[model samples]
Target: MSSLPLTRVDFDAAATRISGKVRRTPTLEAVACKSDPAPGARLLLKLENLQPTGSFKVRGATNTVMSLSDEEKARGLITASGGNHGLGVAFGASMSGCPAVIYLPESTPSSKAAKLQEWGAEVIVHGAVWDDANEAALARAEAEGLTYIHPFADPRVVAGQGTIALEMLEDNPEIDTLVVAIGGGGLIAGVATAAKLRNPDIRIIGVEPIGAPTHHAARAAGHLVTLEKIETAAGTLAPRTSAELNFGLISAHVDELVLVSDPEMKTAAEWLWTEAGVAAELSGAAALAAIRSGGAAVEAGSCVGVIVCGAGTDGIG
Candidate 1:
């Protein structure tokens, strides 16, 4: 495998490369609420849920799809996703006029599948978890001679995801800490790389569901290790293992890895709806959940930013 090519310069270039293709999502000061981390801490929410596909996955998917050669685009795109990434791939392929086949785990919510189809993707329901679906997608890609887009493993995908950090910091240069949700680790891998390169003093904190702490377990073991099983309300974050490239990036750039419970994420989702009028899915609310539950820390008066990475579901009420 090639060494990951993620860098501050790569991220900056990706920002320019994918400009106007992906949403330059806004960053808003978090509304004061009962779930506030610290009384005087300034919390900014990077509203990635506002992306074209309702998730930050569009950044990486669009960048990767757009970078493909004419021949590769003609060969078509294939991948597996828990939800958000599939939506992104579907959208990207549609924009690029390429056929996309997305393998989704059996547990994927129907709404996500419907959205993927709405974007003209050929959706295949396979396996019980993301890893299983991913294996099926890879096999199909090989059999069909299609280009496989690994959700969080490829360098282009990571660089594309890094664009979120670029926009966040550009919008708020004083952001001293960034809290992001981790699934296969693409978003944080990219965001941490760019954010740390931009300001080494800035802290990059990663949040994962306690039931699906793929990156957390990998960090503890000091190597990638697949979970025997995963169970979480944050289905998008239930990948059994973090990609090796993503693990290495997390080790190098991420400052902290915190686990939040499904309940905590659910409460955070509710809080976002009631307090901020933002309807965040559980995965999208994971970062805020970490802060609210004290799994991730914020110092008073510090400028903290959270990536609200997706809003694929209706209000969990």
Candidate 2:
């Protein structure tokens, strides 16, 4: 798993390596709701929000951190994230017996920061935004000879995320469309790669907040384009730009990208909690919001899958 596009074979290897260690989160058919789809039109939820670190990021972080060589492992690991990614690194490093250092934006929720510290990672409060925190983490990793475990932008992480789609497809072969939330685009990249490999016809739709539409902007420019400013309640999806690797994968595999409002995500989060007893943060619920807003309409009988990706929330009990 070098620095190349993640494929199904890499996903298979990752799935084998991390099998029992990670949860095979369940997929549930959507029940009729007052604000969701009309009766007789079904939806499916892949409940990755229920994962141990309360997010799908654990799958990628665990895979990437565990893939480190013994020498790399001995050197320790460093990462930067807004919240959920930091938790994943902290949790994964603990399992692999590696010392972890996490850098987070000043705006990171205290609930998420506390969770990372509780998982035994050294938490550094740095910069006002993610990019600034990332720069600090990179400098520290280089100065301290630590292995940098990126939240995204690495092949191993992408492969690990792709495995989620493989699991979901295995559970529900009839699935024709997948709605996924995009931040740095690792989750969607991996998932789109795997979904296309298994079923090229499956529609891969990426949901982004209107305020932070990295993919949409990049696609329009026909290259990875950085946004001037970030503004979103979906903090996990606030990356200023998609990486070149993620852009390539998304350009090649993802079928569509849609934008949703913060209010729409809030409604979806509340609905999921009330209807399914699932606790989802704004980023995790954005995918379902896309579908409900008719951004991802499907045939009547077709199964459409949405990833409830993460839940590192102050609201989670």
Candidate 2 residue lDDT tens string, 1-317 = 12445667799999997798889999987785566552445688999988888899988998997788999988999999988888888888898898999999887888889988888899998987788899999999999999998888988989989999999999998888899999999999999999889998888999999999999999988998888888887778898876888888889999899999988788778778878888899898899888777776666767788899987343232
Model 1 lDDT per residue over 1-317, tens place: 12456766787777887898888888878766465554679989999999878899999988888888999989999999998999888888998899999999998889899988888899999999999999999999999999999999988899999998888888899999999999999999999988888888899899999999898889899999999989787889899987778988889889899999988898888888888888889999999999999999888889999999998544367
Question: For model 1, where is the 10-residue window of minimal lDDT?
Answer: 1-10
The model with the greatest TM-score is: 1
Question: Residue-pair clashes per candidate, as listed?
Answer: 0, 0
The TM-score between candidate 2 and the true structure equals 0.95
TM-score of each: 0.97, 0.95
Badly placed stretches (over 4 Å) of model 2 are 1-4, 38-40, 312-317
The lDDT of each candidate is 0.88, 0.86
RMSD of 1: 1.9
